[model samples]
Target: MSIEEKVTSIIVDQLGVEKDKVKPEASFVDDLGADSMDVVELVMAFEDNFSVQIPDQEENNIRTVQDAIDFIKENQKA
Candidate 1:
């Protein structure tokens, strides 16, 4: 499956959110209602699930779902 789908599933499972609500434009805070801790958990979940380490400097660059998708796609290729 694509990275977007995988990431979306993680967000849904972790945050108890409906699968349909994880659109690319949905903001983690304003749209998805994720708090700071949830955001942290989401990042960690992505890192763990993909077995890729997201550097602290790069983490800030992943503000949107598409950004995460791109990061995973580019980094997860061994």
Candidate 2:
């Protein structure tokens, strides 16, 4: 699957939402109904999926699905 699909699934599963609801323009807090804890779990999921450790400070920068995907793409090992 594509990165977008994979990221979408992660968000959907983590937040217990519908896949169709996770759009690129959707905000995690406003549109996706993600709370602070959901955001934490999403970061953990992304770290696990990418096998990369995202520091606490850096986690704050990841507010959207695109942010997660970009982080993984940049940090994921070869």
Root-mean-square deviation per candidate: 1.3, 1.3
Q: Candidate 2: what lDDT?
A: 0.84
lDDT of 1: 0.85
Off by over 4 Å in 2: none
Q: Quick one: RMSD of model 1?
A: 1.3
Residue lDDT tens for model 1, 1-78: 777889999989888889998888777777788887888898999989999889988877877777788889889947
Question: By how many angstroms RMSD does model 2 differ from the true structure?
Answer: 1.3
Tens digit of per-residue lDDT, candidate 2, span 1-78: 877888888898889998888877777888888889888888889888868899999888887777778888888887
Each prediction's Cα lDDT score? 0.85, 0.84
Q: Which candidate achieves the best lDDT against the true structure? A: 1
* Residue pairs that clash (backbone atoms under 3 angstroms), model 1: none
